[model samples]
Target: MGNFIMGKGSRPFVMENQMLMRHGLITGATGTGKTVTLKVLAENLSEQGIQVFLADVKGDLSSLAEPLENNPDIQARLETLGVKDFVPRSYPVTLWDVYGEKGIPVRTSIAEMGPLLLSRLLGLNDTQSGIMDIAFRVADEQGWLLLDLDDLKAMLGYLSENAATFRSQYGNIAPASVGAILRSILSLEEQDGDLLIGEPALHVADLLQKPGEEGMIHILQSQKLYLKPALYSTLLLWMLSELYEELPEVGNIDKPKIVFVFDEAHLLFDDMSKALTDKIEQIIRLIRSKGVGIFFVTQSPMDIPESVLGQLGNKIQHALRAYTPKELKDVRAIAQTFRESEGLDVAEAITSLQTGQAVVSPLDPDGTPMPADIAMIYPPKSKIGTLAEERYGELMRQSPFLFKYEQRVNRESAYEMLSTRAEQLAREQEAEALRVQLEKEAKEKAKKEAKNSPRSNREGITERFTKNIAGTVGREVGRTLIRGILGSFKR
Candidate 1:
């Protein structure tokens, strides 16, 4: 694998592409260049012909499609960093969106999303989540494909109707719990979930495209999606899970087959259930063997769980303010995680660093952490801001997948099948009611005719006496059989 230039330190700091598959992190304060570092990493990885997938949470990352503007400040920084052969150019890029506004629509079936992530998206409590799991199980057993929101709603309704049947098999699902889950799902729909769950779902292969030496950069336009933090984070995690499941194990290749950069990574961990948290941690640890790299971009290292933090081999930390005692404690705690380097006070350097500069700790050839150094991260070769709306639209139109996922397709799924079942049941009930009414009318007419006949007095009395005697004998025999059957068994 070719060496990856991270930025400039006392010397040119390089990252081995092979080690990138090991995972990494980039953390800093709000305005201290976390996004820039993220861009830099993406640019370098793409240049090495490794596919990159990242979310443009703030919409600025879309500028990766256009070259950066040359300026005096940029030239001066390049000189200070002792860079040569630096050119302002753009890389191969693709845009996608869940809302189908900024880019091609990206969707996934509710069945593929499964219950675990959906429960997290809905913020369901333990019991409510259990009820959702039961819904999925019932759907699986019945071979229903839950492709959209209505499909899930249909499944929940069916479960409620047959709660007694499923209670022993799955669990006791309370009607109130099912109602709460349905209400939560409706609330999710109100948050634009309809655009997110549908047909022509996102294929994992689309994310791993490389047409030239520079790998394709897939940017998820998430400006509007960021409004619903849970939705955005849950979607990202779902993709990650898909990557882990779809990609085969390559076992320590020269470079990662794909590099995934998770911007605003803290949203993935916030209020996560223990079960999900454990699964995420396991994925992070094992996905490296699949030749996939995961870089989490967040504000502070503390924002990441300790188990996950241990997995990130490359660390690029930007500035952090230590104006308060608590802030200082956090800063010191973050600084201690780095390997000790002589002549570099990690804590002091952390708070003193300026924009576009970070404390770098990339892994060496032997897969060991290099001594941490305060380095100036290079500016991205791509545009520093987003592209014009027309340009963005044009680029979206040129995408090969534009035609594939453009039109919405609503095939037969759980929702339609359940609706048909309901209609059929309703018609059957109506027919049965009509038949009962006709039988009642016929019996009344026959009884009136018998009373009007001359033989009513003679035959009616004799028939009544015979029927009473037969009914009495039948009841005695039935009672004796029931008693014998009951007495035969000991409780």
Candidate 2:
């Protein structure tokens, strides 16, 4: 085989028809054609009946929604590759924002985000994660809704306030544990808490849909999200988990519901706890059943866990600089990931691959691995780099879901209800204080009147008061008055 210019010469590989929904990976160092390769694959996938989901880490992918202006190089490449009817067209693209301010609101409620995924985003270590877990469990039991970070924070606060009470039920929530866990969640809020928590979160079903006419691409911008790696990973994994929960068992299909591209995958694995890592492993393993495929785009395969790397059946490795021993080791390891080819020195080929080129070793439609081929990656139909600024905003303005998510909807969730409850409690306390003040004033006035007047007047007052209430009822009025001072008040 020669250059299988997707759509040109009937694609030498079976993927030309449709297999990307099964999933794929596009990885390379910065400045390489990772983004371009992604665009090309996205365009091709859109060409098929399937839809695509792209994480536009740098925001450049916004150009994908626009039509590609014909350039000499792209035209020449397409002609030489024998591409048939290659019309530069735009795919169905949706702009999604976790914060819901920048793009269409893509949010998942905290109730939907269970404890396992939430713990890692909090950056909780083993013990701290356990405490966080307990907080979630306690929230569920107390009829509390953990809809957002504030809800979780409230859960933590309730635990600390009633630590003595919860110790028996939840097993020892220490002051130190409380401090560590609260600090962790607070830090996350400062970083991504506001963005992660709230109403109108992402719906996994939206991602699964083929948004437009057949073969249109869907891209997600991730430039603003680089700072919150923990939140980013959690959200990404949460998406996968949601897919698993919603998608029924499809056994096997020629294509997937949607192909997920996880660019900058190293951010997800860097310094993550063992528990977090294991949870990621579980999601990646099980999500396949839901017909959702995941691809990790990183500098080297080492950035991904061995468990996850093992699960990724499709591999597209680009050039690597083998200037250092570790670099060379990484190159060799990447070579081992593919089916060994006779004419190819994959290890050597990796270091020598030209720009816009990679070792494509997709699992053939038959489920058997194809031979590693040094294929010329298809040129992206979109502009080489990000679309101009204001491009995404324009897209959002025209989006159908604009009115649905553009205007922020503040539902009466925990935050609003808690604020209301606090006000009610304050009013109740104020009324009780006023009643006590009035009673004190009456008692003092009664004593003064007794001292000024004759002793017969004080005796007459007591006799009159007793005579006034003597036949009222069998109820003990004195015990009721005493109960007000010593017993708990519900008002």
Best by TM-score: 1
Q: Which stretches of candidate 1 lie over 4 Å from their true place?
A: 457-491
Model 2 lDDT vs. the true structure?
Answer: 0.70
Best by lDDT: 1
Query: Candidate 2: lDDT of 181?
Result: 79
- For each candidate in the order shown, give its overall lDDT on alpha carbons: 0.88, 0.70
Model 2 TM-score, all chains together: 0.83
Model 2, range 371-466, lDDT digits (tens) per residue? 888776667766666676677778788777767655544565555555676678767876775686567557656655665677736566777577
Q: How do the residues 1-491 of candidate 1 rate in per-residue lDDT, one tens digit apiece?
A: 67878798976678899999888989999999988888888889888899999999888998988999978888999898888988999888889999888899999889889899999999999999998898888788888889999999999999998999988888787999989998998899999988888888899888887777779999999999988998899999999999999988998689998999999899889999999999999999999998899999998999999999999999999999889999999999999999989999999999999998999999998989989899998878888977899887888898998999998899999999999988887777666655655665575567657666787656767886775586567556655654554444322
In model 2, how large is the Cα lDDT of residue 157?
Answer: 69
Query: RMSD per prediction, one decimal?
Result: 6.6, 6.1
Q: How far is 205's C-alpha from truth in model 1 (Å)?
A: 1.4
